[model samples]
Target: MSLRDRLTEDLKLAMKARDQLRMDVIRMIKAAVLNKEVEVKKDLDDAEMSRIMTTMIKQRKESVEQYEKGNRVELAAKERQEISIIEAYLPRALSQDQLAEIVDSVVRETQAASLKEMGTVMKAVMAKLAGAPVDGKLVSDLVRARLQ
Candidate 1:
Protein backbone atom coordinates (compact mmCIF):
# COMPACT_ATOMS: atom_id res chain seq x y z
CA MET A 1 0.00 0.00 0.00
CA SER A 2 1.05 3.59 -0.56
CA LEU A 3 2.27 5.65 2.37
CA ARG A 4 -0.87 7.77 2.12
CA ASP A 5 -3.10 4.73 2.49
CA ARG A 6 -1.06 3.46 5.42
CA LEU A 7 -1.31 6.84 7.14
CA THR A 8 -5.07 6.89 6.65
CA GLU A 9 -5.45 3.42 8.09
CA ASP A 10 -3.21 4.24 11.03
CA LEU A 11 -5.16 7.41 11.64
CA LYS A 12 -8.35 5.43 11.84
CA LEU A 13 -6.76 2.94 14.23
CA ALA A 14 -5.42 5.74 16.39
CA MET A 15 -8.83 7.29 16.59
CA LYS A 16 -10.48 3.99 17.51
CA ALA A 17 -7.79 3.16 20.07
CA ARG A 18 -8.01 6.62 21.63
CA ASP A 19 -4.30 7.19 21.09
CA GLN A 20 -4.20 10.93 21.48
CA LEU A 21 -0.49 11.30 20.69
CA ARG A 22 -0.64 9.07 17.64
CA MET A 23 -3.77 10.78 16.40
CA ASP A 24 -2.21 14.24 16.67
CA VAL A 25 1.01 13.17 15.01
CA ILE A 26 -0.82 11.52 12.12
CA ARG A 27 -3.00 14.54 11.59
CA MET A 28 0.06 16.79 11.61
CA ILE A 29 1.67 14.58 8.98
CA LYS A 30 -1.45 14.58 6.81
CA ALA A 31 -1.72 18.32 7.04
CA ALA A 32 1.92 18.73 6.06
CA VAL A 33 1.44 16.42 3.09
CA LEU A 34 -1.70 18.23 2.00
CA ASN A 35 0.01 21.61 2.28
CA LYS A 36 2.89 20.37 0.14
CA GLU A 37 0.47 19.00 -2.45
CA VAL A 38 -1.26 22.33 -2.64
CA GLU A 39 2.05 24.15 -2.95
CA VAL A 40 3.28 21.88 -5.72
CA LYS A 41 -0.10 21.37 -7.42
CA LYS A 42 0.39 17.61 -7.44
CA ASP A 43 0.16 14.58 -5.20
CA LEU A 44 3.45 13.53 -3.65
CA ASP A 45 4.81 10.04 -4.19
CA ASP A 46 6.06 7.81 -1.38
CA ALA A 47 9.56 9.23 -1.76
CA GLU A 48 8.25 12.77 -1.38
CA MET A 49 6.13 11.78 1.59
CA SER A 50 9.14 10.18 3.27
CA ARG A 51 11.14 13.29 2.58
CA ILE A 52 8.49 15.40 4.27
CA MET A 53 8.41 13.13 7.28
CA THR A 54 12.20 13.22 7.48
CA THR A 55 12.11 16.99 7.47
CA MET A 56 9.52 16.93 10.22
CA ILE A 57 11.71 14.66 12.29
CA LYS A 58 14.66 16.95 11.80
CA GLN A 59 12.63 19.95 12.91
CA ARG A 60 11.49 18.14 16.03
CA LYS A 61 15.05 17.14 16.85
CA GLU A 62 16.05 20.78 16.68
CA SER A 63 13.18 21.66 18.92
CA VAL A 64 14.22 19.00 21.39
CA GLU A 65 17.72 20.41 21.51
CA GLN A 66 16.44 23.91 22.00
CA TYR A 67 14.05 22.81 24.69
CA GLU A 68 16.77 20.99 26.56
CA LYS A 69 19.06 23.98 26.32
CA GLY A 70 16.29 26.11 27.77
CA ASN A 71 15.85 23.64 30.66
CA ARG A 72 12.44 22.54 29.44
CA VAL A 73 12.75 18.79 29.91
CA GLU A 74 9.06 18.08 29.51
CA LEU A 75 8.86 19.89 26.19
CA ALA A 76 11.97 18.10 24.96
CA ALA A 77 10.46 14.77 25.95
CA LYS A 78 7.28 15.60 24.08
CA GLU A 79 9.26 16.50 20.97
CA ARG A 80 11.16 13.22 21.22
CA GLN A 81 7.88 11.31 21.43
CA GLU A 82 6.67 13.03 18.29
CA ILE A 83 9.95 12.17 16.58
CA SER A 84 9.52 8.49 17.44
CA ILE A 85 5.96 8.47 16.13
CA ILE A 86 7.01 10.13 12.87
CA GLU A 87 9.90 7.72 12.43
CA ALA A 88 7.58 4.70 12.59
CA TYR A 89 6.46 5.34 9.00
CA LEU A 90 9.95 5.82 7.62
CA PRO A 91 12.28 3.13 6.30
CA ARG A 92 14.71 1.64 8.80
CA ALA A 93 17.59 4.02 9.33
CA LEU A 94 21.05 3.17 8.06
CA SER A 95 23.55 2.20 10.72
CA GLN A 96 26.54 4.46 11.22
CA ASP A 97 28.89 1.81 9.87
CA GLN A 98 26.68 1.29 6.82
CA LEU A 99 26.51 5.03 6.23
CA ALA A 100 30.28 5.26 6.51
CA GLU A 101 30.71 2.43 4.02
CA ILE A 102 28.44 4.16 1.52
CA VAL A 103 30.34 7.39 2.00
CA ASP A 104 33.64 5.62 1.38
CA SER A 105 32.31 3.99 -1.78
CA VAL A 106 30.91 7.25 -3.09
CA VAL A 107 34.18 9.00 -2.36
CA ARG A 108 36.00 6.42 -4.45
CA GLU A 109 33.36 6.51 -7.19
CA THR A 110 33.54 10.27 -7.46
CA GLN A 111 37.34 10.28 -6.95
CA ALA A 112 36.73 13.00 -4.40
CA ALA A 113 40.32 13.72 -3.38
CA SER A 114 39.94 16.87 -1.32
CA LEU A 115 37.59 18.97 0.80
CA LYS A 116 37.03 21.16 -2.25
CA GLU A 117 35.03 18.28 -3.80
CA MET A 118 32.92 17.85 -0.66
CA GLY A 119 29.78 19.19 -2.30
CA THR A 120 30.06 16.76 -5.21
CA VAL A 121 30.61 13.85 -2.86
CA MET A 122 27.71 14.92 -0.64
CA LYS A 123 25.40 15.14 -3.66
CA ALA A 124 26.41 11.70 -4.93
CA VAL A 125 26.10 10.09 -1.49
CA MET A 126 22.67 11.62 -0.91
CA ALA A 127 21.51 10.43 -4.35
CA LYS A 128 22.68 6.92 -3.56
CA LEU A 129 20.80 6.93 -0.24
CA ALA A 130 17.69 8.50 -1.67
CA GLY A 131 14.37 7.27 -0.18
CA ALA A 132 16.28 5.84 2.78
CA PRO A 133 16.44 7.49 6.21
CA VAL A 134 19.85 9.13 6.79
CA ASP A 135 21.27 11.92 8.88
CA GLY A 136 22.78 14.49 6.52
CA LYS A 137 25.00 15.90 9.27
CA LEU A 138 26.46 12.48 9.95
CA VAL A 139 27.03 11.93 6.24
CA SER A 140 28.77 15.26 5.91
CA ASP A 141 30.99 14.51 8.89
CA LEU A 142 31.91 11.10 7.50
CA VAL A 143 32.68 12.46 4.06
CA ARG A 144 34.82 15.22 5.52
CA ALA A 145 36.73 12.74 7.69
CA ARG A 146 37.16 10.32 4.77
CA LEU A 147 38.36 12.94 2.32
CA GLN A 148 40.87 14.47 4.70
Candidate 2:
Protein backbone atom coordinates (compact mmCIF):
# COMPACT_ATOMS: atom_id res chain seq x y z
CA MET A 1 0.00 0.00 0.00
CA SER A 2 0.99 3.60 -0.47
CA LEU A 3 2.27 5.70 2.40
CA ARG A 4 -0.96 7.63 2.57
CA ASP A 5 -3.03 4.45 2.72
CA ARG A 6 -0.75 3.01 5.39
CA LEU A 7 -1.07 6.19 7.41
CA THR A 8 -4.85 6.04 7.19
CA GLU A 9 -4.86 2.43 8.28
CA ASP A 10 -2.52 3.26 11.13
CA LEU A 11 -4.81 6.08 12.19
CA LYS A 12 -7.71 3.66 12.38
CA LEU A 13 -5.60 1.21 14.37
CA ALA A 14 -4.52 3.95 16.74
CA MET A 15 -8.13 4.91 17.28
CA LYS A 16 -9.13 1.31 17.94
CA ALA A 17 -6.23 0.80 20.33
CA ARG A 18 -7.02 4.05 22.19
CA ASP A 19 -3.51 5.26 21.56
CA GLN A 20 -3.97 8.98 22.07
CA LEU A 21 -0.42 10.02 21.24
CA ARG A 22 -0.25 7.92 18.10
CA MET A 23 -3.72 9.01 17.06
CA ASP A 24 -2.83 12.67 17.47
CA VAL A 25 0.34 12.26 15.44
CA ILE A 26 -1.46 10.38 12.71
CA ARG A 27 -4.23 12.96 12.61
CA MET A 28 -1.71 15.74 12.29
CA ILE A 29 0.04 13.89 9.48
CA LYS A 30 -3.23 13.30 7.63
CA ALA A 31 -4.16 16.95 8.03
CA ALA A 32 -0.81 18.01 6.65
CA VAL A 33 -1.19 15.69 3.71
CA LEU A 34 -4.67 16.99 2.98
CA ASN A 35 -3.46 20.56 3.24
CA LYS A 36 -0.72 19.86 0.73
CA GLU A 37 -3.20 18.30 -1.64
CA VAL A 38 -5.49 21.31 -1.37
CA GLU A 39 -2.63 23.76 -1.74
CA VAL A 40 -1.20 22.11 -4.82
CA LYS A 41 -4.41 20.74 -6.30
CA LYS A 42 -2.80 17.36 -6.73
CA ASP A 43 -2.52 14.08 -4.92
CA LEU A 44 0.81 13.52 -3.23
CA ASP A 45 3.03 10.76 -4.54
CA ASP A 46 4.92 8.52 -2.12
CA ALA A 47 8.00 10.70 -2.29
CA GLU A 48 5.99 13.81 -1.55
CA MET A 49 4.28 12.11 1.36
CA SER A 50 7.63 10.99 2.66
CA ARG A 51 8.90 14.56 2.42
CA ILE A 52 5.95 15.73 4.49
CA MET A 53 6.68 13.09 7.13
CA THR A 54 10.33 14.08 7.17
CA THR A 55 9.37 17.71 7.68
CA MET A 56 7.08 16.76 10.54
CA ILE A 57 9.88 14.76 12.15
CA LYS A 58 12.28 17.65 11.79
CA GLN A 59 9.80 20.07 13.35
CA ARG A 60 9.22 17.73 16.26
CA LYS A 61 12.96 17.35 16.84
CA GLU A 62 13.39 21.10 16.93
CA SER A 63 10.48 21.43 19.34
CA VAL A 64 12.03 18.80 21.59
CA GLU A 65 15.32 20.67 21.64
CA GLN A 66 13.64 23.94 22.44
CA TYR A 67 11.51 22.41 25.15
CA GLU A 68 14.52 20.75 26.72
CA LYS A 69 16.48 24.00 26.71
CA GLY A 70 13.52 25.74 28.34
CA ASN A 71 13.54 23.12 31.11
CA ARG A 72 10.20 21.73 30.05
CA VAL A 73 10.92 18.05 30.30
CA GLU A 74 7.27 17.04 29.99
CA LEU A 75 6.84 18.99 26.76
CA ALA A 76 10.14 17.62 25.48
CA ALA A 77 9.01 14.10 26.17
CA LYS A 78 5.72 14.74 24.39
CA GLU A 79 7.57 16.05 21.40
CA ARG A 80 9.80 13.01 21.45
CA GLN A 81 6.74 10.80 21.43
CA GLU A 82 5.32 12.67 18.48
CA ILE A 83 8.66 12.29 16.71
CA SER A 84 8.60 8.56 17.26
CA ILE A 85 5.17 8.30 15.73
CA ILE A 86 6.05 10.42 12.72
CA GLU A 87 9.35 8.65 12.14
CA ALA A 88 7.55 5.34 11.76
CA TYR A 89 6.56 6.53 8.29
CA LEU A 90 10.03 7.62 7.26
CA PRO A 91 12.79 5.48 5.80
CA ARG A 92 15.61 4.45 8.09
CA ALA A 93 18.23 7.12 8.60
CA LEU A 94 21.64 6.83 7.02
CA SER A 95 24.54 5.93 9.28
CA GLN A 96 27.45 8.35 9.65
CA ASP A 97 29.66 6.18 7.47
CA GLN A 98 26.97 5.77 4.80
CA LEU A 99 26.35 9.50 4.82
CA ALA A 100 30.05 10.21 4.47
CA GLU A 101 30.36 7.84 1.54
CA ILE A 102 27.42 9.47 -0.26
CA VAL A 103 28.77 12.93 0.42
CA ASP A 104 32.16 11.94 -0.90
CA SER A 105 30.59 10.63 -4.07
CA VAL A 106 28.56 13.81 -4.54
CA VAL A 107 31.57 16.02 -3.92
CA ARG A 108 33.55 14.14 -6.50
CA GLU A 109 30.67 14.11 -8.99
CA THR A 110 30.19 17.85 -8.64
CA GLN A 111 33.91 18.60 -8.74
CA ALA A 112 33.45 20.56 -5.53
CA ALA A 113 37.04 21.41 -4.75
CA SER A 114 36.41 24.21 -2.26
CA LEU A 115 33.86 25.45 0.25
CA LYS A 116 32.49 27.82 -2.36
CA GLU A 117 31.08 24.82 -4.18
CA MET A 118 29.30 23.46 -1.11
CA GLY A 119 25.85 24.34 -2.44
CA THR A 120 26.47 22.45 -5.65
CA VAL A 121 27.59 19.40 -3.76
CA MET A 122 24.72 19.58 -1.33
CA LYS A 123 22.11 19.75 -4.07
CA ALA A 124 23.58 16.74 -5.78
CA VAL A 125 23.79 14.78 -2.57
CA MET A 126 20.26 15.61 -1.53
CA ALA A 127 18.91 14.60 -4.92
CA LYS A 128 20.83 11.35 -4.85
CA LEU A 129 19.78 10.63 -1.28
CA ALA A 130 16.18 11.72 -1.63
CA GLY A 131 13.67 9.69 0.44
CA ALA A 132 16.45 8.63 2.81
CA PRO A 133 16.88 10.24 6.22
CA VAL A 134 20.10 12.21 6.49
CA ASP A 135 21.34 14.81 8.92
CA GLY A 136 21.76 18.03 6.97
CA LYS A 137 24.20 19.49 9.48
CA LEU A 138 26.33 16.38 9.39
CA VAL A 139 26.30 16.39 5.61
CA SER A 140 27.35 20.05 5.59
CA ASP A 141 30.22 19.33 7.97
CA LEU A 142 31.35 16.39 5.88
CA VAL A 143 31.25 18.39 2.66
CA ARG A 144 33.16 21.25 4.30
CA ALA A 145 35.79 18.93 5.65
CA ARG A 146 36.24 17.33 2.25
CA LEU A 147 36.49 20.65 0.47
CA GLN A 148 39.02 21.97 2.96
RMSD of each: 0.9, 1.2
Q: How do all models score by TM-score?
A: 0.96, 0.94
- Model 1 worst lDDT window (10 residues): 129-138
TM-score of 1: 0.96
lDDT of 1 by residue, 1-148 (tens): 9999999999999999999999999999999999999999999999999999999999999999999999999999999999999999999999999999999999889998999999999999999999998889999999999999
lDDT of 2 by residue, 11-30 (tens): 89989999999998898999
Model 2 deviation from the true structure expressed as Cα RMSD, one decimal place: 1.2
RMSD to native, candidate 1:
0.9
Give stretches of model 2 more than 4 Å off. Answer: none
Top-lDDT structure, candidate number: 1
What TM-score quantifies how close candidate 2 is to the native fold? 0.94
lDDT of 2 at 135: 71
